[model samples]
Target chain A: MRVPILSLGEVLVASIQDALTDRGWRQLQADLLAQAGRRPPPGSRRKTAPRGVVIDLSTMDVMDSYATRSLDGIARMLALRGAETVVVGIQPGVAFAMAQLGLGLASAGTAVDLEAGLALLAEQVRGDGRHHGA
Target chain B: MAVTMAPESRLPVRDDGEIVGARRAARALAATLGFSETDLTMIATAVSEIARNMVEYGGGGEMTFAVIDGDGRVPGRRGLRITATDHGPGIPDVERAMQDGYTTGRGLGLGLPGARRLMDEFRVESAVGVGTTVSMTKWVV
Candidate 1:
């Protein structure tokens, strides 16, 4: 199973929204859709469903509730298409804050730092393929 | 410099499902106070939850935010103070309202309790037929 490496940098939800209006978010969704329709990477394993998505959240300067909820919506949308998502680099403090805010991503899948997240994804892909396999 | 504080600006809850606006307000306020991103998110989430509660259960209310400095004044670290007040029918039992997974409607009932959990200081006051006021403070430092 070939996995893509997603490196998340500092993302400030406040800054992102300020930089892009609602149109920007719409554009992002459109871009993702267009990209997903493209051909798979060379020598990629063919499975019942496409491999999952990896998100790097380590560089997030500030993540507000609105962004968290929006991200949640995005994750759920991707899940419907049988794509697993791995969110890495979420600060422990931020994770706690998200939990307190009721984001509940912890239950959705595995969350870890960059190294751990990748290792976990690799293990999941090697082990049961059914963890997120649709 | 005499800092002016008004709680009325933050009042007038709206449950139009405008989560963006709620978070926007929180980020803006936290930034002005030099709060961290984590703290900013927490404040915005609390505001969103409480505001939703006002619209859902209390039939809407007014919210107010105040700037609090920690020169050994109030308790905890320095931070901004947010208060939501509503004249709608108050909660019959405050304790039940604070409990997690407790809701009178389709909601997850994570409003009040969830908001309280995000902030360092939280207080709720309510009376039958009168209304309810929820005050929360998040440390900036």
Candidate 2:
């Protein structure tokens, strides 16, 4: 399925609602990267390129190594484009499975949900020396 | 008394979709046996990894989910058994394949090792150019 990347103010949110095929994941990466790189033209509601990306995985019951690594790559690439990524809504069961499998998103910041994701983004850009350097 | 009505399912893991089907089947079957939600997710995730590898490396394969009793060694112990078999270019170095971060340059190389860690028992039998079979089981806790 084509995972939609919704722009929430300065944050782009993609809620994974189903099993993403290999192509689906690749497509999401491309779309998110493209969107993350693009800035709203002048005269838009607020300015600056998107500051953060939120990927929701509540509906994803299975996060195999493939998915975990893909998400990590997305976070790193987005950082390169000056956008931070926050993964949110990982199910408890899925989290346990990931821990057992020794799979993890090493670089991406994680939040409990979308609201917290946005909050984390805001905090990172707050210029308070707590942004984790990106 | 043992539940003799142990059910089993075989799913053809050909494409990405079938890999999903296999995961669902595993979770559903495990649920019927009263596996906890965490266990269900673990089984499903392990199935996903092995099934994806079957398609990505083995060019397609089959997955079998069965509620099996322990074989002689631990009789009456019932749990879920997952076996994935593929007839493709088998691994030349099975040992290396089971190591974390040992990939053929496509993925993070954690599929096999991660799957193994999720399950209680895991065994991989492969012959270069012959075929590969992975059998893993998670006992009820």
Candidate 3:
């Protein structure tokens, strides 16, 4: 199934609700990249470029090495498109397991929850004035 | 440890969907054994890693789960044992395979070592051109 991606002004949000299959992950990557390249509908007031992307994993209870690689790949791909990636809502248990497994997403920003994630994105946008003011 | 409950289930690991199914099955069993949310998540993650490895590198395999009762010294100790087996080309070097950042596939190379860390006990046996089997266990405190 396609994980929905919601656009909030200059930031894109995707809440992963379930364990994704390999195909689902591949599709999500393609969809996110495609959405990032989309232009504001002719004469729309919103900004044409996305400044940041927030991936909420609150509902997800488990992540394996493959999933970790997928997240890292997505972050790298978004960086190439000039968008910062923030992964939020990692549970304490999941964090422990990830650390034990030596899985780390070094390139992406991480936060405790959705609010912090959005705030982090906003801070990034404000810090780099080029992507501010939708 | 004596086998208090020999309850066992086998799941086919052929694709990504099957891998998720295997994780769910393992989680359900672990949950019933009074595993904490953290423990459940750890077991599920380990299951996923091994199941995926079976499908990816082992050319499809099977996952078997069983419950074991601890001895008198460790009273009330219960653990879930998960075994994954595949009849495919086996790992040439188990030592290198267990090392971090050593992957033959397009992955982060954390599957074997990561799964081992998440579980209390881990054992693997493989022979070139024969097959591979990985067994892991998580105990309840």
TM-scores for every predicted model? 0.62, 0.91, 0.95
* Pairs of colliding residues, candidate 3: none
- Weakest 10 consecutive residues, lDDT, candidate 1 chain A? A8-17
Higher-ranked by DockQ: 1 or 3? 3
Please give the DockQ score of every candidate, comma-separated: 0.22, 0.77, 0.80
lDDT of 2 at A49: 88
Stretches of candidate 1 exceeding 4 Å from the true structure = A1-48, A54-83, A89-93, A100-106, A111-123, A129-134, B1-8, B69-78, B139-141
lDDT of each: 0.62, 0.87, 0.90
lDDT of 2 by residue, B58-130 (tens): 9999988888865546667778999999999999999999998898858778789989989989999999898
Q: Model 2 over residues A89-125: C-alpha lDDT tens digits?
A: 9989999988887877987999998889889988886
Fnat for each predicted structure, in order: 0.32, 0.87, 0.87
Model 3 C-alpha lDDT per residue in residues B11-123, reported as the tens digit of each score = 89999999989999999999989999999999999999999889989999999999888744686688999999999899999999999889998766788998998999999
- TM-score of structure candidate 3: 0.95
Interface RMSD for each predicted structure: 4.9, 1.2, 1.0
Candidate 2's DockQ is 0.77
Worst lDDT 10-window in candidate 2 chain B:
B1-10
- The candidates, ranked best first by DockQ, are 3, 2, 1
* Span of 10 residues, lowest total lDDT, candidate 1 chain B: B1-10
